[model samples]
Target: MVKLLAILIALCLGQAIVAERIVNCYWGTWANYRSGNGKFDVSNIDPWLCTHLSYSFFGIKDNGEIQSLDTWLDYDLGFINQAVGLKQQNSNLKVLAVVGGWNEGSTKYSSMAGDWNKRQNFINSALNLLRNNGFDGLDLDWEYPNQRGGNWDDRANFVTLLREIKEAFAPYGYELGIAVGAGQALASTSYEISNIAQHVSFINVMTYDFAMASDGKTGFNAPQWAVEDAINYWLSQGAPANKLVLGVGMYGRSFQLTDASQNWPGAPCRGVGAAGAYSGDGGYLGYNEICLNNWYTVFDNDNAAPYAYSGDQWVSFDNVLSVQWKMDFALNKNLAGAMVWSLETDDYRGHCGEAYPLLKAINMKLRWT
Candidate 1:
C-alpha cells in the first residue's frame, strides 16, 4: 500500500518525486560489546538523525518465531525498549527490527517462506513481536533467498512470504522493507524484482561490498557510478523509483599492498590490511578509524571515491565528497532516498571533529534548502 500511496501522491502532486525521502539507518546491537570508543549503545543514537532506525539481526527460530539474537542485552537488559523509546523523543521516527542477516544464513528464511502454515505463524509472531514491543514494523534482511544453502523453490516462495507479510502489516500500518543484494547476477537469481517491489514499502539496495576480481588486487568497496548502476539496473528490472533507497557503507575494505610502489586499483595485495583499533578486524576499518589516519588519500575521478595509502596499507572507502556524489546520483535518478548500512561505523565518536560525518553528508545532500 505504500507504493500505491506513493503513486497517488505523485499523481496528485504532478511531479516525479513522491512523499518524504527517508534516511533508513541500521544499528548493529553487537557494537555495545566493543570496548572504549567502539562501544555504541542504543541511547547514544541521536533519535532525530535518521527517519527510520532498524535494530538489526534479530534471529529466527525453527518454529518461525522472532528471537532477539542477544536475549540478555537486547530484551532482558532493555536494549529493545531503549531503541523503541527513541520514538518518544522523535515522534516521526520509525523503529524497525531486522530478522535474518548474513550470519543467520538462508536456511531458516527458506524453510519459513516455503511452507504455507509456517508463513502465517511467522507473520503472527512478527506482528505480536512488533506491536507488543512498540516497534513501528519489520525489515526482513534474508541475505539471499535462493542461494547460500537454500532450496531452489525459495526464489518464488520468498515473494509469497513478503506478500503475506505486507498484507498482514497493512491493517496495523506497519512498514515492510527488505535489504536486497546489489550485484547484477545475484540480484537476478535472488529476487523477482517487479514482483517483490510490489509488496515492499521500500527496497534498501545494498550497493557496497564490491570486490573487483579474484586476482588478489585492491578495489573500491563502493564506487559512485557502481551505486548508480545498481539503481539503474533495479529500475530497468521494473522496480519503482520512489520505493528504492540507495545504500552506502560506513566502513572500508582494506588490503595490505604487496609492493608499496604500486598503490592504485588492481594493485597486488599481500593480504588484508592491519586491523583497526576500534574494529579489531583485519581487512576492514570504520570511518572513525580511517578518517583519523594521516595516510595519503587519492580520489578516483572515474569512480568518484577515495582510497588512502600509507606504507603497505591501503583502504578504499567513501568520504564526504564521494558520498555526496552518490546522493546526487540518487537524486538525479529520482530514487526515494539514501540508506547507511550501519550507524556505528561512520565516525560516530567525534574523533574526526564531528559525529556521524558520513551520515550527515548523506542527509545534507539528500535534503534541500
Candidate 2:
C-alpha cells in the first residue's frame, strides 16, 4: 500500500514537470520579405502557443563580435524589439537571439572559440546584445565546431566557450542553448557532447536535411530512424534526455528526377526541384507552399514521413501526421521537448485547412494546450 502511494506521488510530480516542457520555434527574420507569399513578421506570430521563440540568425564577425545578418530587419527597422515584445502576450515566453547558421559559416566561430580573449569578447558582445535587445538568452547555431572549416581542437574549445557563456549568463538569469547536427557522424565528430551537455540549458538536435539535392536521391528529409538514432547517440554520449529537444523541419527537400518513372527513395535525381512558392529556394519547399501546391502524396510507413511527387519534381517534408509522430517519439524518450525549424514555414495564415496545423499537431501530441 505504501509503495502504491509513493508511485502515485511520483506520477503526479512527473506530470507537473512535463507541463513545462519547451515548445521552441525559430522565427525567421527574412520571412517578412518572401515576395510572392504574403509577409510573415513578428506580428503574425502566436506567442502564446510557444514557450520559447528564437530569432533565426545573427552573424558572427571576424572579430568575435555578433552582428545583424540583416541590418534593417534586425535593428534599423526594430523587428528585434517587436519580437521581444511578444512577451507581453505570454509572460512566460522566452525570446532568444540565435547566432550563426549554415550560410554564416564556421570560420569566425572557430577563431573566437579557440582563443580565450576572443571568446571573452564574443561572450561580452552576446550579453550586451541580449540586454539591449530585450532578449532572454542566446542560441548558438554554429554549423559545426571541429569541422566545416574549423580546426581539430574546436571540439574541446566549443565546450569551453559554452561554459564561459553559461557562467556569465547565470548571474543574469539568462538561458543558453545550441542547435546541433543530428547525424551520429557529425555529432560524434563536431561536439564534445559529455562536456557540452553540462553547459547549455538545452540542445536542439537538427534532424532534418537527412537527404538533400546534393545526395542525388529522393528520400525523407528527416527520417524517424535518424531522429531516434540521434537521440540515442546523444544519450549515450552522456547528454540528459530531458535537455534534448527534437528538431522537426517545417520545410521539405526537393529533387528534380532524372526519370519520372523511377521517382522514389534512392532514385537518381538531376538537381534540386524548382523554386518553392514562398521559400523561393530551389530544392526546398516550406509547408505553406507544400499545402498550396497539388502534388500526389506518398507515405513512407517505415520511416513515418510523407513525400510528394508531381510531374518530374519530388519533395520530402513533414505534415500534421508526421509532426504528431515526432512529438509522441519525444514523449516516449522523455525528451525536453520539440522545436520547429522556423515559424514562417508553417500554415500560419489559415490557408491550409487550419491555422498552424503542424504546430497544433505538436501541441496536441505533447498536450501543451
Candidate 3:
C-alpha cells in the first residue's frame, strides 16, 4: 500500500492550486435519469474534484420567481438536500444553485429583467431559494440578454438585475455569479461585460459550443485557440483575469461526414452522428464513451485541439492533454480557474481505466497564481 500512498500524496499536492483558483463544476441533475452506467447523482460525485459545485439548473417563473424545473428530482428525491450536504464533507465546497439555462429561453428572462417589480420578485425568490435550499449562492444563467427573441432593453436591464441581486446577496454574504456567452459575436450582443463583471463574484464564460451539430460542418466543440480568443476578448472588454472562469465542455460535438473520405475539420456534414451507448444522445459523446473507443484521432495543427473519427462519424473534443493545455493556458494568463460544463460527462466511471480523468486533468491545472 506504500506505492498507493505515495501516488495519493502526489495527487494531493497538485490540488493546492485550487485553494486560490476556482474549479467550478456543474452537476446537471438530469444525469440521474440517464440509463444504466450513464446515471450519475450526488452519491457519485467526488467532492474533492471541484472547488465550486453549481447545481443546475433551477428555472425562472413567468412572474420572475425562482422555480425548480424538476420538482421530483430536486425535492422529492432529495438531490438539492444531498448536494448541499456535501459541504459537511468538504468545508471549502461552495454549492451554488444555477437559475436559467439554454432550454429556459430568453423570453421570460427578458420580461423579468425588463420590469422593476419583476426584478425584485426575482431577487426575493433567489434569496429564498438560497436560504431555503442551503445553497451558498445563486448563479444567474439567463442564456443571453437581448438575443433569442428578447427585448431591445435587455442589454442594460440584465446589468440592473445583477446589480439588485448583488446588493441583496451582500448583507447575507451570498455570492453572485453568471454564465455568459463567450464569443465576440455573442458576448457583444448578450452582455455589458464591464458592468456585469462589477456585480458578480465569478464570470463563468461559456466558451464551448463554438461549433455545434447544426453548423453542418465538422469542428471542435471547444478549441484551445477558440477558448484563448474568448478569454482575450473578455479581458479586452474589462473582465478581470482573476474573476474569469474558463468554461470547458466535457463532451464532444459529432457529425456524420457527407463524404466518407472527407473527415477533416470543416468537412461537410450530412447530419448528427449516431447516439452513444452510454450517452444515449445523438450529436454528442461523453468522454467516457470516446476515450474507451479506438477511433483514429487527429490533432488540429492550427488550434492544437483533437478530433476522432470512425468511418463517416466525426467528433471534436478534448482529451487529457488538451484539457491540461487549457488549464496551463488559464494559469499562465492568471485566470481564476476553469469550469467544466458538467461533472457527469467526465469519465467518472473509470470505464477505460482512471475515473474522472478529465476532472483529474483539470484539477491538476487549478493554480491561482
Candidate 4:
C-alpha cells in the first residue's frame, strides 16, 4: 500500500506538469479512427501525443439514429465522461470532442445559424455534452465557413455560433476552439476571424494540404513559407498572436511523373498515390501510408520540412525537425501552441520517427525558455 501510494503521488505530479505543457491531440477520428476502443493506450504512446485526447464527433446522416453532431455528442459524453472518471482515478489525460470535419462539411452549422432558438439548442447541446461526458473543452472543426458551397448567409452566423458557444461554455468552464484552413482564400471566404478571435480560447489552423496534387512535382503541402504566410495574414487580420495555434500535418503527399519529358521540376515522377494512378480527389498520401507502402523516403533540412522520392515518385512532407522550426517560430512570435493531425499515423519506431521526440523537446523547451 505504501508503494502504491508513492506511485500514485508520482503520477499526479507528472500529470500536473503534462497538463500545462503544449496541447497535441490528433483529430482523434477519421476513416482510420471513426469507431474503435475510444480509449488510446498512452502507455507506449508519448504523453505529449496523448496529453489531450480529442475524439471527433461528426456523423451527419438522416433516418434518425441519433447520429449527426447530436448523436456524436452523446457518444463522446458516454465514452469520454467515463474516460475522464478514469483520468481522475488513475490521473492524466485531458480529453476533448471535435465537431465537424473536412468531409462532413459545415452544413449543420449553416442550418443552426440565424435562428436564435436553434442556435441555443446547438450551444446548449454542446455544453450539456461537455458537462455530462467529462470533456475539458470543445473544438469546432467546421471544415470551412465561407468559400465554395458555403452559404454567404452563414458568414455572420458562424460568429454567432462562436459567441453562443463561448457564452454557454464559459459558465461551465469549458474551453472553446475552432479548426481553420491555412490559406488566404479561406480567410477571405470564412467567418470573420478577427471578430471571433478574442472569443474562443485559440484557433487551430489547418495549415497543410497545399494544393493536394498527387504529381510528384508539386511543392510542399504545408510549406514553412506557406504556413508563416498564413499566420502572418491571420495576425495582420487581427488574430491575437497568443490565441493562435499552428496546425502541422503528421502525413506526407506523393505524386508520380508521367515520363522524363513530362516530369516537372522538383516533381520526380509521372503521378502520385497508388503508383501512377490519378486521383481527382487529391494526389497527396499520408506519412503512415508513405512508410507502409515504402514508396517515398523522407529528407529534412533546418527549414522545418521533409522531402522524399522513389523512382518516378517524388514528394515533400513535414517532419519533426521542420516541426521544431515551427515551434521555435511560435515561441519567438509568442503564439499560443501547435497541434498535429490524427496521432495514429506518426512514425512510432524508426530512425526517422520524430513525433514523440519533438513533442518532448517542445515540452522541455517550454519549461525553460
* Model 4 lDDT, residue 160, Cα: 78
The candidate that wins on lDDT is: 2
Q: What lDDT tens digits, residue by residue, belong to model 4 across residues 1-369?
A: 999999999988876643454465664433322223222333324543445666666443322111344444344435444445546643556677777776667665666665677777667666666776677887888767765356887778888778878887876788888888878887768868788896898888888887455433556777777889898989888999878887777776656655534333354454554431211123555555455456444544433577666555656676556777777777677777777785644544432554455455455544333
Model 1 Cα lDDT, one tens digit per residue, 156-242 = 898899999988999899999899999788898898899999999999999998863344999989987777778889999999999
Among these predictions, the greatest TM-score belongs to 2
True lDDT of residue 44, candidate 3: 89
Q: Model 3: per-residue lDDT, tens digit, 1-369?
A: 999999988778766645668889998899998898899999889998888999999888888998999999999999999999999999889999998898998999999999999999999999889999899998888878888879769999998988989889999999888999999999998888899899999999988888876888888888888899999999999999988999888889889999979999999999998898777878989887788778999988677689999999999988888888888888889898889988998989888879998888887667432
Give per-residue lDDT, candidate 4, residue 293: 52
- The order of the candidates by TM-score, greatest first, is 2, 3, 1, 4
Error of 3 at 113 (Å): 0.2
Span of 10 residues, lowest total lDDT, candidate 3: 360-369
Off by over 4 Å in 3: 1-18, 367-369
Residue 217 displacement (Å), model 4: 4.3
Query: Per-candidate TM vs. native?
Result: 0.93, 0.95, 0.94, 0.78
Residue 314's lDDT within candidate 1 is 92
**Candidates arranged by lDDT, highest first:** 2, 3, 1, 4
Superposed by TM-score, candidate 2 places the C-alpha of residue 193 at a distance from the truth, in angstroms, of: 0.5
Steric overlap count per candidate? 0, 0, 0, 21
- Model 3 misses residue 233 by how many Å? 0.5
Model 3 score (lDDT)? 0.89
lDDT against the true structure, each candidate: 0.88, 0.89, 0.89, 0.63
Native-structure RMSD, model 1: 5.0
